[model samples]
Target: MSTTYHAAAVVGCRIPKSKIFLTEKVRECEHNIPESRIKDDEFCAKCGKPLWVTLHKTIPEYNRDMNTLCTFRVFDIEWEDFITVAGPGAVSEVANDCEKPSQLIHLPASDVRKRMERGLEKIGLWDDNEFGIWAILWGS
Candidate 1:
């Protein structure tokens, strides 16, 4: 019932397929179960895939800090890159604020744009100038 906004980006990177997990479609699965109802050992009755998988890694210490923001990164297998779809304005912002040691990989916007264009082409939407693509990709 509430809406929130944050800055995000799509970073091009290669993630091993072994690390990826699949899940069943929510509410539309054969059992009509939500992701919360699925257990780790359980698989979809229709497709035999997980009901859901946790892809984001959260830092527990940051949870206690009111000033700190948590950024979530989602791996887009089709695009072969990491998409920071929610939370902090930037991943570097979170990394800089971390009390522990951390490293940030900053990719140039031009390079990311190239990959994004390729992803759009893969999906049959080749218009790089399209406002909808930009809005959805950048989470605007």
Candidate 2:
């Protein structure tokens, strides 16, 4: 008996769909910030280096249906400002608490990744590795 060989062609690489969103009108949450509490005794999570009391406010860009969308302010303070730490969940919870009309939208993880990719593309590094992209965002 004779044998026959078959081959399959690859079409595209598999990657998570980018769903990140951007808003140009990001507002800083007016939540009262306590006095400088960060002390030299504090250690960073990754480097374990001493951290100083500091806080900053920024407004990232986003796009949504203006008619159906609502604006909200988020305060992203230094790691020391948080007690339990700030994750996606924590950010959403805080946003909900201080949202307009007491309503806030929680951004999905996939969307977050997409938004990040979009940001990278803006800087001409859309094809970079995940680690590099993340470093850019974290550093910013």
Candidate 3:
């Protein structure tokens, strides 16, 4: 069988920008924002805005005929309001600390893909017809 990868839907909501409140927790040059990305609790450095302030829980259902036990976190923000639905091990970090990506690139997919040392396969998104059928039958 061929190795395939499927996307787990990530939805992002655009949060309104406001003045950043800096604490002793995250300090410039000392803190690892560029390395570890932003922790949910960390505030933005530019505007001191947080990347993820609130979380909205969502359950994904393939359809009425099938039952699925899965929860997804979605975000909607400026520049883009889309999230990649990485399958299982593809995003192991999200389940561990809720940081989603242990490493992140807010840039376009092509740019991000270039930086990735791993191979990325397009098994498609949740709304695809073939993916839906497959999900209904074998989804976790």
Cα misplacement distance, residue 101 of candidate 3 (Å): 11
At residue 57, candidate 1 shows an lDDT of 37
Give the Cα error of residue 117 in candidate 1, in Å: 1.4
Who is ahead in TM-score, 1 or 3? 1
Candidate 3 accuracy as lDDT = 0.29
Which candidate number would show the highest lDDT if scored against the true structure? Answer: 1
Candidate 1 local lDDT, residue 78: 48
TM-score order of candidates, best first? 1, 2, 3
State the local distance difference test value for candidate 1.
Answer: 0.36
Most accurate candidate by TM-score? 1
lDDT per residue as tens, model 2, 5-119 = 3221111111122222222432233333343533223544445544443433221332223311012122222342211111122132212223333122255545544554554
Candidate 2's clash total is: 12
lDDT by residue (tens digit), candidate 1, 95-138:
22224422343555565456545544453433444311111222
In candidate 1, stretches whose alpha carbon ends up further than 4 angstroms from where it belongs are 1-103, 124-140
